[model samples]
Target: MAQTGSTYTKCRQVGTTSYNKHMFLNSECMSAIDCAIMCKEVATCTAFTYDDLTKTCRLYQKIETINCELNKENGGITFTKETECHVNWETCGNSCYFYEGTTRRTLDEAIEYCISQGGYLAEVTDEEELDLVNSMIKGSVLLGCTLYDGYWQGRTSGQKLVFNDTMWAPNEPRGQGHKCIQIWKDHGKFDDISCLGIGDIICEKVSILRFHFIVTKASDL
Candidate 1:
């Protein structure tokens, strides 16, 4: 079944004309779909409004109004966060990362598991992001970048894995038999190892919401 309020509606009257205190950022978007995608990618965006006339996409950290209202003059629509990061997934930057510490799996198995959960293996983009992942993980975890042909490529982005000396451990990326990458907990640096070895899984997904409501437990009730 289709989700309610997923489609855009025409604006009959002027709602909130000026940018309110709730708005965090605004950008240019071609369509409502593009606006929605932008909102999803932002970690702090809980709601958004897109102006058809000006091609303006406004992202809000919180929605002040009960309903997502549209701008009458611009003939635009608004959208609120309808979904959130999956349970046990941590929101970081533009993606939701799930760190599985206890269970260990091979590189192939880890990739399959993340794919089954509508995500891909975790890809550390920068030093700052790597530090955040290092703080969350208890032990060594498998990463998304793998040795493809000759260069390292990300499974999710299909892009070359770019890194500096600071991103890697001392004498790492052991070329020959080592085909997979892992984040060493002790040093918090990238390490290349054989794909057959077992390691903790870290999964990454993009579609996430800012606010996550707590689910009450039946046992507590």
Candidate 2:
């Protein structure tokens, strides 16, 4: 069993049966990590299996404990389970967010830092997500959405953004050239400001499970 926000040790082999609700064939999964991300996206998914031979990934609602088979070629299958995020990160709505206030980084610097850490600026699209992000802010922080080409857009998806009006503070987005968005910790609302402005940084990426390979003897098959 895996504990949320803790390391997981046990792994399992897939049985002959397959769960069809969430399947990632070769075209969808380039690696086991990709498969894990797919599993993480589904709130109901509890485990996943990546087949090294067919390059297939499948999701399950529970761990498999019977009818296990081992491939002749070193098993060639890796099983993984959902686990808690790493330190300093919060997992919600199928995404992982990292908030840091110790050092302030400019918008560009924040983007660079997030890229270096394998994520991008946080993008809060809905009120639920916005509220979750708001709860994490100790102070203002740069978000992924920015004013681009006369419209607010999410950098990751490049789609037009339409957040709830209540998310913004009174008379907010006050001036021109204040394109980047920030979450004001005091009010838990948003404010538009210059991209060059500095503040705490929030990085976001798809939720992921820690990697753990299962070992099963041939006799167990």
Runs with alpha carbons beyond 4 Å of true place in candidate 2: 1-83, 209-221
The sequence of per-residue lDDT tens digits that candidate 2 reaches over residues 82-155 is 55666778877567888888899888889899888888888887777777787788888889888978878988
lDDT of 1 by residue, 40-92 (tens): 65556677766668777677776663132332232334466755567887766
Error of 1 at 194 (Å): 1.9
Model 2: lDDT to the true structure: 0.69
**lDDT (CA) for every model shown?**
0.69, 0.69
Work out candidate 2's RMSD over C-alphas: 9.0
Q: What TM-score number comes out for model 1?
A: 0.64
Q: In model 2, how many backbone clashes occur? A: 1
